[model samples]
Target: MEEMIKLNSDISVFLYDVLTKRQEKNAKYSLRAFARDLGISPGRVSELLHGRRLPGRDLILRIADALKLSPLETEGLFRLVHRQKLVQKENGGARQLLADEYAMVADLECYGLLMLMETEGFKSDIEWIARRLNVTALRVQSILERLERLNLIRSRYGVYERLQHRVTSTHDTPSDVLKESHANVMKHAMEALYNVDLNLRDITSITIPADPDKLSQAKEEIRLFRRKMAKIMGSGKTREVYNLNIQLVPITK
Candidate 1:
């Protein structure tokens, strides 16, 4: 009956809120029902609520889905539960590095899953998403779950919405996740070059020879162009999903 608690950084506290909300909606909703939804045992759910055990990454994601949390709330749940997992590993006298490795590895996802949610005529239907993204329906279903678990999208009354936009991956400190994002986009671009109509896709390139010292200025110019194009793109109604790649590659490197 109270305002939903704003999540910051505590899994036990979050679970408590979930339990309370479930009971409020149905006075008969018991811990066993919560466990059934989470795919965990009732005793285990109680342990989580009581802070006697830390939730595994898989379990935490299941919990998020069971709670039907909004995207932002799901992200907070992930960050908090991940922190708790690390603390749990450390408290067991195990090296914290292992848990930290798990945390880092778990942070990545293929970009397509989230990007497709932004396309025109976006729907929560698995088959629609599969056709739009040119992926298998089964893969689309997996992607939907991944996006929901990562809190990148939310499903409310069977309608899905993207909560965040514009992903930036720094070349300064490369990551496997970042590399994978670029790889997925590049593959799609390659497909467009061969399969898409000339008018439907724009593929262009330029060659410039200049002093290496001006690389910073060149980067700034590219940034400005990207923003300008984004502004132009936003002026019209979005009819379809599009990918824009501004690649600056060295011919001599």
Candidate 2:
């Protein structure tokens, strides 16, 4: 079962490889092209694509819009990159501090909160959040309550602040193991957020019938399709885009 999970994660990582390559190629033709469109810089664009650096929420939204990635796809990309880093660490790549226990901020809501915090630090009033997010104060309050309950943010003296900077466990775990666990958690979270109707049991059962060669072919096909979708959407011609935030998962059951 673990092996099968790893195989699926490997397949997902393969898709991300193609997507990143496509993004890089698109950026190569005109570093200024995306930068101009995004109101950033060629240097920043390079850093974002290759440096494994996290961009601010606004920049992420701008890039996502420029790339024409769907909200779900944007989220998926964040997850993929995060898993990639973990994979690298497992293979003797650079290491970083693990995150302490805190809230799980998934999807757009996470991005929204991060943006507000970045721009305005922390605030306790829902009105402030609503004004910033351009939503009703009631909605902002609900979001804040949810975020606090999730432990993603903490409220003190009516102001909400980010609890931690990282998400993965700091304890010792093999890099590969961390990557695998991260991938599974990300996929699960994404599916839940986007309501992706992936009948996992059905998929596993169906795949079980295929021969090794056929399964390999199918996996490649899926990877190619994901790549194509990513390429087409990331064309930098869209007006609206979503900001995908970073996520990390520990390698523990």
Candidate 3:
């Protein structure tokens, strides 16, 4: 049996190495079995190994998990895949995120799913997540799959975990998608205002004259404030999840 060697930047070679290592342990191992274990079709796996196709980020993560790669190896694989994506983009072959993908980023429930995973009482059950996020179990199921495809979350042995602490909508996201997300958040805030106990929630606002020229600086300050509050609230014995929404918009323009 050979020890795992240093993986090259080429995914094809890395995959070949994985296959060879498995064959060393079990001479009966077949390509179909390999593909099955990796959760990809045999033809697609062949294309990847033959360098006819590059693995997408989702496929890369799936392969990494199937191979049970070490943390360092997983990071290396991601770097390689990202470089490949850059090359594809430069070659005008890059696939942009589909509208559905953008919608996932713009879904406020998706953000709630991530945050809920951090709470002390978090459960991976769809019903539990649905209840916690105020969404239907079906919606929770859809968001879980979408988040996994985005590599923001992963499930292993029936336990789901957040790969990222937070995610922001990409700058390229359409205005309507962003607006939909913001509207959802605002709706939640409104509900909490009347339904939640005053001691358990805080909703405060202030309006002041502002300089439009310094709007960028003001945005940066807000970003920092959000991070500061996240750190403060995330510390010590977290039992619940909360969202902090801040709005900075002109009333008259």
Candidate 2 clashing pairs? 66-236, 67-233, 67-234, 90-175, 103-151, 103-152, 124-158
| Of candidates 3 and 1, the better by lDDT | 3
Model 2 residue runs over 4 Å out of place are 1-105, 120-122, 168-253
Q: lDDT of each structure?
A: 0.62, 0.49, 0.74
lDDT of 2: 0.49
Give RMSD (Å) of candidate 3 vs. truth: 10.9
1-253: candidate 3 lDDT, tens digit per residue = 0133243434665676677678889989988999999999999997776555888778877988888888777777878767656655553442233355668667677777877888897888999888877789999999889877655566756999764443343346688887888898999999999999999999998999888999999998998898799889999988888889999999987
Model 1's TM-score against the true structure: 0.56
Clashing pairs in 1: none
Over 4 Å off, model 1? 1-113, 166-174
lDDT of 2 at 64: 58
Clashing pairs for model 3 are none
Write one digit per residue (lDDT tens) for candidate 1, span 1-253: 1124343234655666666667889989887888898888989886665556677778867877777777776666767767656655544411122222223323222355565565566678888777776778987767667655433445656887653353332223345654655666677788889999999989988798868888899898997897788678756776566667767778897
Structural similarity to truth (TM-score) of each candidate: 0.56, 0.28, 0.62
Q: Which ten residues in a row have the lowest lDDT in candidate 2?
A: 200-209
